[model samples]
Target: MVTRARRNETDPDLGVLAGRLLFAVQNELFTSLAKEGFDDLHPRHGAVLAYLDEGGVRATELARLSGQHKQVVGTMIDELEALGYVERKPDPADRRAKLVCPTARGLAQARAADKIMSAIQERHARRIGRDTFTMFKAALIDVTDHQRRQQPQ
Candidate 1:
């Protein structure tokens, strides 16, 4: 059996490293959120919650921002609505369009998530030095942007 210690002998590929980082951070964030009375939320909900704003956002925009298909985003919206995290309302600019507006509970969750993420980043920055952490973030963003640009339109 290949022990985890033995696996560390070789450098991980970019995807593995990225997945590890993502899942680790998500685990910490969700666990903390659950402790704070948001036990109903899961990591998948981030596709919708991450882009929500007070002014309300269109479901199509959420799909675009989240890189999810419109149908998937629509389903997520339905789930969030059922959970009392959001509501569908008429768009002020377009009567034919519906806007997804965050509920008070959703806003509270967003606030908590922001605080938690900030603390997590701060902890990592302190460990690696703020300047290095900043550089790392910039490099990561560059890599991600390059990858996105490479995708077929």
Candidate 2:
């Protein structure tokens, strides 16, 4: 159903809603992970871990994915290194650039987070009807895609 913005409303922007929803999801996942004795991991760390587990990536690429600076990403990588969660390897094409990959322990942690995310999404799906949840996801994806396409070069 189409709805109009309420008069005098202060927050009808989708960006605001997206940020709030992201925070809610992250907060839940963090709480769930913390209970399992993974309190040392952080939200940003989780993002980097997920990215690395998918495959090796340059530090700059990871920074772009995380919307953080390269220096900050490098710092986070160092922390992950200290925790034995990630390690740097030689990049095949660029010897000077390092490829980041998660350690076995990091992969395990990412997999655990995956399960937690699934459970959280399942709970969300149950709260909202299955069809409603599907439509909501599609709507969000459509908006995100459209915004990306509209960005000026």
Candidate 3:
């Protein structure tokens, strides 16, 4: 069996760089939110919050959009409900189904997250030239769109 060659320290892979950046941004946003009186909110909760609709969305749809297992999203919704961020109600279209809705507090949290993300993007643009940052974002969007298109529905 042939051993894989070691990667150079100075040239990290794209996945490594992406993970590091994501972690840093999440940490900063969580800390900022905590200071704004949202101490109960955790970065992982973003998986659900990011895809939430203002009106409401079904639990199954949330799981699909967040790329999380139904059980995992269910647990998260329970926690969010307990925290007064979300509530489960009978779906208007189908009474048999439940919709996960954001409370006023949850809406505030989403707004805060958006603001925090914008600030973080601005910081990145400043550190890496604005053009470079724009290009990076475009490349990421292109890759994500391509991959999404390739995935089986």
Candidate 4:
């Protein structure tokens, strides 16, 4: 079972609820750039960037990771490539496959962004307390794990 989420709560002050949620998301994004240095990145780039950060992967694998069509990943890759965030190399494991890896700059940005995100998360943890934050993270992980496991393998 999942812990109670604010989504189910009917807020007496709609403006406050909306503002808080929006502020949190905006703050996190800005915080990411602030700690990482401003970069021309879009949120959609996040899914792909995270995958590349893990390790080099084939284009098709990225498509799977992003839960987007192969063509969509191709488009995203084009953008990342244009931005010098990633480079593609022919996959030696299989002919006719290309693997994407982050550039040095990309790696640096990823590390910085990771720090920023961690800081924002820490702030949230301070607000909710470690026990609540732990439960929240565990619940989120459980939800995602369950959903992913349900996907066709």
Worst 10 residues of 1 by lDDT: 4-13
- RMSD vs true structure, all candidates: 2.5, 4.4, 2.8, 6.1
Error of 1 at 110 (Å): 0.5
lDDT (Cα, tens digit) per residue for candidate 2, span 1-153: 334545214546777678778888888888888887678888777557757744678889988776667898899999999988888998889899889987887777788789998998788899998899999989988988787778665
Off by over 4 Å in 2: 1-12, 149-153
Model 4: per-residue Cα lDDT over 1-153, one tens digit each: 543455446433544554576577656775567556555777667667767854578888888877778888888889988988899987878768788989887788778777777887899899999899999889867966776788876
Which of the two, 1 or 2, has more lDDT? 1
Q: In model 1, which runs have C-alpha deviations exceeding 4 angstroms?
A: 1-9
Task: Provide the lowest-lDDT 10-residue window in model 3.
Answer: 1-10
Runs in model 4 deviating more than 4 A are 1-27, 34-36, 149-153
Hey, what RMSD does candidate 3 come out at?
A: 2.8
Write the number of the candidate with greater TM-score, choosing between 2 and 4: 2
What Cα-based lDDT does every candidate model obtain? 0.93, 0.80, 0.87, 0.76
Q: What's the CA error at residue 104 for candidate 2, in Å?
A: 1.7
Per-model TM values vs. the true structure:
0.92, 0.79, 0.85, 0.74
